[model samples]
Target: MFRPLELFIGLRYTRAKRRNHFISFISLVSMAGIALGVTALIVVISVMNGFDNELRSRILGMVSHATIEGVRDSVKDWESALAKAEKNPHVLGAAPYIEREAMLQGQRVAGGLVRGILPGEEPKVAEIHNKMKSGKLTDLFPGGFGIVLGRELAYKLGVDVGEQVVVYAPEIRATPVGAVPRLKRFTVVGVFEIGMEEYDSGLAIVHMDDARRLYQTDGPDGIRLKLDDMFRAFTVARELAAELGGLYRVRDWMQGHANFFRAIAMEKRVMFMILSLIVAVAAFNLVSTLVMLVTDKQADIAILRTLGASPGTIMGVFMVQGVVVGVIGIAIGTLLGVVLALNLEAIVKFIETKTGLVFLSPDVYYISDLPSDMQWSDVGLIALLGFVFSLLATLYPAWRAARTEPAAALRYE
Candidate 1:
């Protein structure tokens, strides 16, 4: 219900030359603060999003989307499980695996998780073939006793391709002397690096038959499954578990790594809240700016009141001015945030090139470069919050302006 006269006067006051230069300086500072806060928030959130995606891909590369295992020691009928899983419309592939904890000794001794897999069927459920740094996944034939080691695990055991390592299984064998740990010497056929410390430092791969002989298991311990959509893994696992009639236990990637993802999500929320305070502080600065503006225009307010302008009209004029200032700041911030987030990776690369500095190195970190994935929804939410804070800041100052009495304000004149 604002009149054109009020709008025109508000805009004129905003653009007119100000007597107090400090007010103008403070206004500029507030705008810059808002812009900086928004830019940082957007860039940080985008980087986090990129990191989340990268970690997910690398993890899923080594692990399956879902897994089905017998409630007992081993799945004696794993072939049946694999066949049943493959029949599901949502299942893309399935493979059987046996895993055990063992001590591996080359020149040094190190403990690692020993996983047994079928070379022919491994690629259907996992991407181990693509991650091989040396040797082929098919090199491990039955009775060959060939093993594949993760890069860090190989380093820890001081063994490489064509080298020999002794794997001391947890199983016990009664020998002529006494009960001894069953051990076997295996040739290192391959080395793979998944870049994650947990897997790279503690995982070993060998033929399924060799693992069964070493562990004395009748069959594979579990069946791994790949789904058409990884996000539906939990639901698919539940259905598969039900179809198997409670004989097997089912799990999905999310359940296995819930803590890892939950931590990341919690960190993102905390970061958002912390950055929002910056925008809030800048928005609240509008209070001081408008208060000073109202004081400076006391005589003007009196003139308008005496000229038949209602208190509500006077309030609208000042409100418009404050809103204009906030809108301008918010608009500039939104523009800068979007631009900076989209170009953050390139900007980081440019800085590294110019400064001869390496922010991330593949030798030391999983990700070797800065990554960004700007989401429009995040941008929209930030912009909306900024606008709401700005609007709230205008209220008190506008109300004070409306309370000005014509007689008292004009007395000084």
Candidate 2:
């Protein structure tokens, strides 16, 4: 079998001993740099992706994907709106809701938004049933003032299931008794946890009838729609609003947390750009290493040229050598990244247990655990980009090698 002379020579040069220790040193640094950059990028991106995923699945699970509220009155025949919403191709489930903002006065007083829903109908819209920690959803069905509160909220209020908590809706009522505040007493029937500190600390659920009485709406204040695909929520919301015409107005979860999620996306982009450049700088070190190698092999280049080797072939030989180094670094980095991504949670747990420091604290970061989401597509892109930079780094040094004066360089030998 015939082998390409350039490839054979390039492989030889890549493995050959170097006379200049600095050349070897720079080559080592280049490889290490690429490895570090790739590894760090993978880990950080995975964590960011994990956070993004959590926001969608956990946070969104508790909140409505889109709310179609009656701007004119309490969603005229809310049941009919829910039925039609469920029939929409994009919508998976729909439920009627009556929401109110109130303060829970217990051992410790705190304010939060409370949502009233039917226990049986809620599972179709919100995943509240699944998030329950120590109680059942059915508890909310019992006639008078029964409720389910988020675990963190329960803890903060120093109240448990079966305890009475006073709810005060400041904006809902004003009377001669000094702004009556629509005071109501409710028994905590259950506790739920969704891994989001915000939701767990500031959300509660009650019976729709009770909520209707509090909000004074004709029926449900709005219909919550759950879409098959959450990413298309805004589109579906607009379409629904158009479908319902002047009677209803639609709002998506994206609108509710627009700035927060946008900040996260912007942060990820900036982080990827900064980290990718670290790999570029490392790959650029190939120029110095290859330049030194070309000098050391000057006589060989001259001999090969004298023996009829083309300048392009000479350039290919050096270019291939630089690419080989870069490819090796990329492969190692990719493998390391995959391993880390797969085991990031366990690794962090081990470290935290040993050091006694929390990585993600509910008290600080709104999440109580670490998260990782590895995307193979991101890995492929990182590897491809690293290789391209490494190949580009070869041009100057390879061209220098190709331009060696055959007669003059050979004369020295």
| Best by the TM-score measure | 2
Score candidate 1 by lDDT. 0.89
User: TM-score for model 2?
Assistant: 0.92
Tell me the spans in candidate 1 whose CA falls farther than 4 Å from its real position.
1-8, 307-309, 361-363
How well is each residue in 1-413 modelled by candidate 2, as lDDT tens digits? 78899999999888888888888888988998888788888888888898888877886888889888887678757776677788799998888888878889888899998888988888887888998988888888746788889988999999998898988876546677665657788998899988787889999899998877766667988888888888788889888878766767778888888898999899989989999999899999899989989998899999999899999999999999999989988888888988998899999999999999887776777667778999999888889989999999999999999999998897868
Error in Å for residue 25 of model 2? 4.0
Clashing pairs in 2: none
Model 1 quality (TM-score): 0.92
**Pairs in clash, predicted candidate 1:** none
Off by over 4 Å in 2: 19-22, 171-181, 354-358, 361-365
Give the C-alpha miss distance for residue 353 in model 1, angstroms.
1.6
C-alpha RMSD between model 1 and the true structure: 2.4
Model 1 per-residue lDDT tens digits across residues 1-413: 66598799999988988999988887787777777777778888888898998888889988899998888768877777778889999999999999899999999999999999999999998888999999988999899999999999999999999999999998889999999999999999999988788888999999999999999999999889999999999889889978876577888999879999999999999999999999899888988999998998899999998999998889889888877877788788889878988898888899999999999987788789788889999998988888788888888988899899989998979
lDDT score for residue 35 of model 2: 86
Q: After superposition on all CA atoms, what RMSD does each candidate show versus the true structure?
A: 2.4, 2.3
CA lDDT for candidate 2: 0.86
Poorest 10 consecutive residues of model 2 by lDDT? 170-179
